[model samples]
Target: MFTDPIADYLTRIRNASRAGHRVVEVPASNLKKEITKILFDQGYILSYKFEDDQAQGSIKIALKYDKMTKEPVIRKIQRISKPGLRKYSGSEELPRVLNGLGIAIVSTSHGVMTSKQAKKEKVGGEVLCYVY
Candidate 1:
């Protein structure tokens, strides 16, 4: 039911999931739709596996309207580490570092993403496919 490149990406994710590989979820909002669109335009789709067949693996992402909320809630499917970077000493400093690099932390239907990526593509709402 997926179209071309999107289907391909979904298949890849599904296969990886079946093999027990971990995947990252990036969330986003309207401002980040550009990024999600980019992924779609490039034929990329996100998918995930579930414990039950009936369960929709798709996620629902919403825009952050409250300025009070600073960080997007991210679900860690795999251990994420910066290449060649040591563990951060302070939890408070993490956002400063990520933001310094122009990454926008967002909660998406698929997961979380940097503002840069979200602005580049169009991704939001409920997931239509499980990555794998």
Candidate 2:
């Protein structure tokens, strides 16, 4: 569940899809930047990282729900890890990769996940934004 303008914007997109309207893709270069601005203004994304040498990077984002916040205080943005990579078993193992990327993971009722986690969980929803 998202709030206000962003939520409304996504609704419009969804509605457009239902009505069979052609939707244009936002340019990739500005996609992360725009998301960062939105999340920063809304206090969702806390921080982020980017590197030329690193094919993989991560960002820390927060999940706000009815007065409860989880630990690590951040989350990572990386390629989805398959079940084979989960050495410890269970979603709990995800934090290790996130931590290695300088990300703090927050597990919520939504599930133990990250921006990358959503995909792994096969859960499709809006990506609130990126932190950096």
Candidate 3:
């Protein structure tokens, strides 16, 4: 059993990307599904699919890479709010990742969304992670 599934999810993707894997699979949960959607919508990932099985489902994510450089599009992905120490920010205080070049995923009351979206929606909640 994993104590911090979100962290594990991030690590799996990070490792896969560093290893030049075309796709990475992660154990799924509602929060993870929402995060995956946010990543896809932001164009960080090439594509994603959710598979439901008898036990917990899993997510298959096609990571993005630069056409010419052959470098992974996602240079970094870091967890913010962790199980040990939680991180929260208001819409007004939301962080601007890489000066708006990157995205910060937040879990607001409205739903799990990018920090920019949360700012536009005028709500705040736990800050999940930073992805670029």
Candidate 4:
């Protein structure tokens, strides 16, 4: 049993990208699925698929890479809020990752969305993670 499934999800993608894996799989949940969608929408990942079975579903993510350099598109992905220490931020106080080059995923009352979207929507919630 994992204490933090979100952290585990981020770690799996990080490890797979570092290892140069084309496709990475993660055990999925509603939150994870939403996060995956956000990643796809932001172009951090190439593509993703959600597989539902009798038990907990799984997510298959195709990681993106630079064509010429053959480097992963996601330079860094770090979890912000944790099971132990929850980090919440208001729309006005949301972080600007990499001077707006990167994205901070937030779990807002509306739903999981990018910091920019949250700011535009005038909502606030837990700071999920940073991805660039």
Residue-by-residue lDDT tens digits, candidate 4, 79-116: 99998999999989999999999999999989999999
* lDDT by residue for model 1 (20-131), tens: 4445333323333443443333233342222223343332222111236532222111212322332321222223223343232434454545433434555432222211
Using Cα atoms with residue i matched to residue i, what is each candidate's TM-score against the true structure? 0.20, 0.23, 0.98, 0.98
Model 2 agreement with the true structure over 37-107: per-residue lDDT tens digits: 44444354344333234343322223322235332222323222222342123343334342344422223
In model 2, pairs of residues that clash are 74-104
**Candidate 2 local Cα displacement, residue 60, angstroms:** 28
lDDT, model 3: 0.95
What are the Cα lDDT values of the candidates? 0.33, 0.35, 0.95, 0.96
Q: Rank the candidates by lDDT, best first.
A: 4, 3, 2, 1
After best superposition, candidate 3 residue 118: deviation in angstroms? 0.6
Cα lDDT for residue 130, model 4?
99
Clashes of each: 38, 1, 0, 0
